[model samples]
Target: MLSLAGWSVLIQASLAAIPSYVMQCAYLPGKILDGVDRVNRNFLWGSSDSAKKVNWVGWDKVTKSKEERGLRLHSAKGRNIALLAKLNWRFQIESEALWVKVLKMKYSIKRGRDIFNKGSRWLVGKDSGLNVWHSNWTNGGSLRKLIHGPITQEASFLEVKDIMLDTGWDWGKIPFEISLEIKRMIQAIPVTILSRGAGKLIWAGSPQGTFDLRSAYRLAMGNNMVFNKKNRNSSLALEIVRQALEYYHCVASPRLQTCKVLKGIRWERLPQGWMKLNTDGSANGNPGLAGCGGVIRNDAGQWVVGFSKCIDITSSFVAELWGLREGLILCCNLYITSLEIELDAKVIVDILNKPAYVNNIISPILDDCRLLASRIPQIRVKHCFRQANRCADSLARMSVSLDSVFSSFHSSPVDLLDVFEDDFNGVNVNKLCPEPDVPL
Candidate 1:
């Protein structure tokens, strides 16, 4: 007896409760999916399955954003894969854990040594754990295979740091005759003698030096591209089935309530006589190809100007700072007096606001941003929700494929027009807020 809107909310609530990791591992049977799809159709039409097909748009369109001409419902399969990819990502990046060790030992025992051996290499930190000869430190194979150095049995287990010097590698101390190839390989190894602790393993073919589900899913989908073409409407069908199953699951948790914090906020215009700037940044991978984008608007919420810049391989954090710096520079050139800058990244705002010195790789970029901000008159930088910064987000994403290092737009891009209109209209965007914790 529930209305379509009521059913939709109920279904979403059910979905929110189920842990995404469970769905990632357990592939639901086809029969279960059929029953779920049947229920979704029922709730969507508010009628039985005997009735004519009520679905107008396909499911593929449903999962896309409003800008993409879709309803913005996430695909169950896509979500599952995305979640599961996180597990694989953690396994590669994180330090050894009980669970990780267990999984590794389990697979290695069943598959044998060749299973884990893929010519992968590790960056030496303190070089305490690495074995000089047995470990795969050299480019092609173990160093022992290349040069069987004459040494006492006790020295056979020598670590990589044993030959390290304060300045650089001490290649002369080794007893074996160093070949040209071995010497080249030794020089190529990025061993930091000052660094403390065990070295970290690097996953080959990962551009960001870390694992990502988006990358994993892209690879998985590529293999199934032929299958996808066969059923171009597969997304459409999957959406229907997903909704039905969600509704059935909702019946088990009627008491659950959806949070309303996100729906309550809307994009607001700047104060009179002040310009508003919204900035965003994106990277293909954490330290991969990145881009910075920003949009400046007048008091009336009309776009004054926008910018997109393709930055070389850099972290997303640096990209965000660059976006703000670029926006400030443009505003200064335009002779804007009072300004308000908004960004979706809270971490960047925190780092800038603090007085402490940043001694890391990003210290120079952070200092540049701070210096630029000081020159701007009556400027205030604040954090806003990503939902409200759609135009800037879109521009940043577009910068990824741009050939030019920098580009500026006097007017809004065609693809961002809808999002711009939505912001101007003060449309309420749905964002799921975390539920309040209740003591049992």
Candidate 2:
């Protein structure tokens, strides 16, 4: 049997010797990932089975950095994205490469078309490639979808710069008449002062102007950083701590040098006499195989119940709304008078809280949720950071994997024990802050 030191050396050697190109291009199959995980487990403790040898710290914990309360070991998924991001970076800097030229030729930017293409979207710097109607350079999707009328022949093939006067947009320069809605959309599309170059295409999901593994992994994992006005105080506190740490080197240790103590968010229990309900939904593709899950806990922080259910093909937003609706129904059945529903989707919360808002797509489900909520003596729907809703998040992921249409856990499942413990103790996990801007 290999000694503990031998195992450590072997694991390090395996990581160091792995081919970078394979990491960049290869998406490992489930079987390969399972085999790799087994290898990693065997090397970590000289045994594949956790029953035979204790892993002192969990594998997930080991993969995270110190600031995240982990051992700094890289995750397979993270390493994959990190390595792939290098390819994305290469595309940006090596524009003259033969591969780059081929890609550019194959994926030329057309006006109004391919706006929602999978890979990346062009940023409007000089706006040469952007179209006033079709391109997603402005807000999100195509502007043509928002407009009720066609553009004039004079407006055809016109670049974004044509409507610009010096630093800002010249509304009067537009060839065709514009509506208030069009004006609002045009104004929403920001025209940042271009320092150099005629706009370049960038990954739409990425917040950083440059490619990075962390952002890629978040996109892969379906994690989103939900923001709200209530979180401003925490954001401010985090910024202060960051600035203080920047000026004071005395407090920094070697570990701190490698991993800064970033401000993290934690889960808080509901107020006295209130029950907290966290609901989440998952879909393989946006409208693919979808599922919903929810967990409820009393004010004292004890788990009441948790449920997961497979839903037919639906968008994630609809699935999320359905999850809340189901959770509300469950709460109503239990005769819970005071309830607080927490969801990660801000759009749904905004709609539910709005008395006059009406969405044709979600109206039926929204009506059911509101009706159930109204029956409860005290009820409210609030948006929360996904980090604080791990139990429901776990259940949502499980919903896709399970064969059954629905399942409920009267007691916490083994897989959920850690999440439940963290929730109970107010320990934070998976807290994501917004990405900082790249230097111009």
Candidate 3:
């Protein structure tokens, strides 16, 4: 009987044989073993001088010999070991092939240069026929064509890593060098896609997709970069498109389309003997406890008239309409010809400018203001900002606290001339509105 140590050694040898045997069998058609044999023969006995040396037939014979020997050497005690070894060998071979393909593709730009330029004599010059009398013909046209456009350098790994970080990717655990390389690979693909305008088609097809890319680009470039401005505007345009898409899809909020409508006339002054009127409204809560305000400032910075009132209304829209009405009534009462009016509400402005009327709630009031404004000679209505007219906002806020006092004065035109006159003449207030018409 064999000793235990000797038996163990035999078992180990047998186990190692199975995988090598399987690989030899599987790769027979590919002639993998034939290549190995040639290498082995060259190493051991030197290459044969024969032109038609050992080829695929010789490799097939070697593989067959190895497989037969492996099968005969297999034993029940080593079955699991043999199976595992074969599996490992197969996996390793697959992994190596995949890695080789990846490396080749990754460096294709540099490696493919020769293949791309194979037929171009302009790129690869020919040897002269005679050394002394060399006739060198130039292919300048082909060379110029090949070199068209600027040659852009690839982004550095560090630059790519910085871009990835700006996009909110966390790659801190990866080694700096590895992370940078990976980032460069990822960004390079998108940059190429974007430059070709192919990326726009992809983004346009999906809702909000364009906006997301624009935002991503902005984030990558950073706020300080000039591209950020361009990207941010692009993002806004995309957002508008996305909003429209949502509406078309029936996913938009109803309130998004609803805008405040005003009922007041705007007033202003023209250089050629005319007064301009403007009306505006403000509401802290929609359809509830709203405020209406209007201002009538002439071209001379003199306040002809202005009023702000808090009404127990349901929406800001109503308050806005009320402001228009108040301004129109004031203008009509003042009998100011050549009236110009302004408001900050775009919807209200549109309504007044166009003959068509919408929004039943404010239509009647808007009509009333329109009729009154029409009665005046050369009446005009325009939009102005909340900041442009502080007097109006202050009055609106004050109306909330003094609702009872203003409502009581509806029957009579409360004189605000003295109050404004005193305030305008005040030392502290005068500096700011030094020449009230001269905007700061």
Candidate 4:
């Protein structure tokens, strides 16, 4: 067996013989030393000039400097190899192929106690406890026995510590840790405030200030900046505060506003404890063969009322707004208390929330809808995904058929041929109303 000194020399020689590329690839900048530091002191001690001479010592110095400055320096070739290894590990786990067995074996060897325990005890015994009389019996011998098991628990503990130190997983000295902690604290504050339903307290900014806050929040979150300085037109700290406030406002207030132009009105009862009013309208050409429909339902999933009408409308947007107004009016007429109005128009929703004072045709109509909504108790308007409103959309399309129109308000169900006798000519309206083949 090689003497301790001989073993140390052999280890140093092996490290020295390692290709520069291999060393660069395997070298993790912040990993703690094993027993090789004394023999390979040159690894830490840097050279003066690195660009001209490819010295391992110089590379180590540059890496340390970059890390101290909160910058990461990576060798292209080294990163590629590391990335490949990571991908390979992921592939093995996901694919669960034969290679996964090999990977698990490798991971066991690297992370398992038995293999690494023997190496660690060997190194520690030959170095730290070498000179003690009972060192072998106490520290070294005990450690050897402790690490000798196939599934040595002590080895796992040491391996975990080694990995943590290698990866700089400890948060003790990292500058980013403080910043991250502060961010988390700030984010947590808004969430806590919002959870308590404190909207008025949170949105207590002046009217102009509220607008500014809204604008700033929109720009920041929409553009994906946690603390936007240029768009916020304020200090970085204030920007972050504004973002938090906006987030709080969104979570606390779930009320939605309706479009101003739709003409049809209808109501429906949802399974949940709330009333749903659906309105839809269509225009052929800039207000041509336009049609609108509305449905009202109460919280008990019962159809409260339904309406469909073909109107000589101007635009699709106008029809949509009219549908909203009709729905709201129906809710008021029925004395329904808690209401949720849903539409698919995003523009109408935004316009209702923040009405512009400019000379726009839709302004007055939108303001009217907003005013009407404010008078009602617990009325919310929301944008629904199109898929959710297919029933209402079908009714709107059905209303445009002339035969379906005059058959309206018949205390009895009227046959399709009775309403438009001339148009039907001999075709059956019942056959035409073919069970809307698609599932709702």
Cα deviation at 89, candidate 2, in Å, is: 50
lDDT of 2 by residue, 199-285 (tens): 655554543334445545443433322111022233566677878887575556433323334556666887899998899998777
Model 1, span 221-259: residue lDDT tens: 333322121224536666788788899888976766765
Residue 41 of model 1 has an lDDT of 46
Off by over 4 Å in 1: 1-262, 435-440
Candidate 4 on 210-300: residue-level lDDT in tens?
1122222222222222122123342567667879999999889965753343222222234566788766767776535566676665565
lDDT of 1: 0.65
Model 2: CA > 4 A from native: 1-261, 430-440
CA displacement after TM-score superposition, residue 376 of candidate 4 (Å): 1.2
Highest lDDT model number: 2
TM-score of 3: 0.33
Query: Using TM-score as the measure, which candidate wins?
Result: 1
> CA lDDT, every prediction?
0.65, 0.66, 0.41, 0.42
Which scores greater on lDDT, model 2 or model 3? 2
lDDT tens string, model 3, 59-163? 222222121221122222122222333333233235468764674466432321221122111101112121111111111112223322432232222222233
Question: Which candidate, 1 or 4, has the higher lDDT?
Answer: 1
Candidate 2 lDDT (Cα, whole model)? 0.66
